[model samples]
Target chain A: MSWRSELQALRDDGFDVLDWLSATEEDDEVVVTACLVRSEDPGSFRLVRSPAPVESVVDMFPSAQWHERETAEMFGVTFEGLNAAPLLLPPDSPAPLRKAQPLPARLSQWPGEVDPAKPRRRQDPPGTPWR
Target chain B: MAMNPRASLELIAENCTSCMLCIRACPVWCLELDAHLEVDESSGRRRSSLALDRFSIDYGTCMMCGLCVDICPFEALEWSSELPPTQFEWRSE
Candidate 1:
């Protein structure tokens, strides 16, 4: 079944609490997860999806708005119909959590590059060859 | 009962083999280590050993989790009860 339909079904089944929503950037795509809970029950329901234009659950769960925004900002996941303002980082900042993202600190001179034994030979930082 | 309050992190340079286990284990990347290989042939046979040049921990970024001390294979890192001054520098003595 479609994720939207599944969410709607859960909501209809009295899953009133939207515990949390977040995303992780995998090697190829971003994975978005939403946790739902029912006050009557002790456990929670987790919904995981991998979509380029992920549907926004804000309409179903208002608390998902901020979590979706943060996930979007960090992993560059675009949630459809969710207009998010700049949260922790500036609007133009690169997606820091993406695997392809190059850390600015590693691009600069890293202290670990210094080798006391060999002055001529240099070692690249952890994340090198940004390409 | 006596409570030992955590303060500054101490580095026992002599015991440290520069294995870099602490640096790798640091979640915040606050620890930095630099070492070079030194070879000596004074005892008829050549012996190579890792000589630690510099080792530093950025207390500003350190959360004092004591993971580095616990992860040190050589027991090079330890916790000192003496509180560090506000402007104190973390240098390997």
Candidate 2:
């Protein structure tokens, strides 16, 4: 079933509260998850989707406006009908959370990379083996 | 009176191995550590050890979460009851 239809079905089944919405990068796509809860129940359900140009559920869940904006800006996920206004970052800034985005801190000289006693060989920065 | 008040973070320099664990574990990236390799050949056998050069914590950015104190495997970081000065200045010695 389509994510939109599933969300509609969930809304029909008393899952009225939108707990939170978040997204994570998985491989080349962004996996968006929305936590939904029933007001009378003690449990919550997660709705996951990875479709490109994910359909906006703002009409159903008004709280998704900011989440979609942040996920769109950070992970470069496109949300259809999202206001495209710059939220947290400047309009000219690149998507910072994307895997391909080069970290400015990584490019600069990390103090951990230098071993004063062993000047001949450079040491890798701790927790940054990818560099 | 509180038995264990978290007032200051003290570094036991003698026990530190310059492992960089505290710096990596810090959530705010407020900790900075500098070290160098020291080679010893007293017994006609060469051995290398890490010698700490500088370690500084930016209290302005640090949230006092104690993650660094708990993650220090060498017991280098500890909490003290002595409160930090109101107008504290951080300098790396």
Candidate 3:
């Protein structure tokens, strides 16, 4: 069965979404997890994970709108029913949290006692094409 | 007045080994340094030392939190309450 139906069934079973977040995974994919807490027992909670490009459960859970929008913008993921609006970040800014994204600094060498042989962050000039 | 040793920042520039531990500890990025290594002709050995070209702390932004003094591995930095009044020959603004 689809995750939308599963989330709805859980909601009917007195589960409420406490929070939601996303993390990058292997193979250039992302995972979105929802923290659901049972209404009868706030101490008991469950983490539900689903791969990116998954269907949005915002229609069944209105609180998922911000979460879905944030995940979509950060990981370049798509949600089937989500509106075309930016959230959390300015429109057109790079997805900084993604593992593939380049860091902001350009240190010529490591400072202090750090091992010099260890690879440092890439120092691409601004406006260079991103990988 | 007896100065409190733990309330102000001090630096013994000659004792610095330039390890840059204090630079990394600065939360506001107020510390800066430039260094170079060269062979000492008399000693016949290579030695590293800071150039003092850009080793300046922007007092405007420094919160005086003392993280830089505490993190100096070479014991070059210290805290003292004997700091003199701010004296400037000119003003930028």
- The lDDT per prediction is 0.75, 0.75, 0.63
Which residue runs does candidate 2 get wrong by more than 4 Å?
A126-130, B1-7, B19-29, B34-53, B63-73, B81-93
User: How high is the lDDT of residue B33 in model 1?
Assistant: 84
Off-target runs (Cα >4 Å) in candidate 1 are A114-131, B1-7, B24-27, B34-50, B65-67, B84-93
The complex in candidate 2 yields a DockQ of 0.37
Which residue pairs show collisions in model 1? none
The residue-by-residue lDDT of candidate 2 on B1-93, one tens digit each, is 775578778888888888877876776666777777888999899999988877777677677899989999999899977765433333336
TM-score of the candidate numbered 3?
A: 0.58
Worst 10 residues of 2 chain B by lDDT: B84-93
* Per-residue accuracy of model 2 over A17-78 as CA lDDT, tens digit each: 77777687777777877778888884866565655567888899898788888888887778
Q: Which structure among the candidates has the greatest TM-score? A: 1
Model 3, runs deviating above 4 Å: A25-27, A88-93, A105-131, B1-15, B21-31, B38-72, B75-93
Summarize candidate 3's per-residue lDDT along A1-131 as a digit string, tens digits. 56676677777888875556564666656776778788788888777777776888777778888877877888788889889488778889877767667555422332332311222533333232452
Q: What share of the true interface contacts does candidate 2 keep?
A: 0.32
lDDT score for candidate 2 against the true structure: 0.75
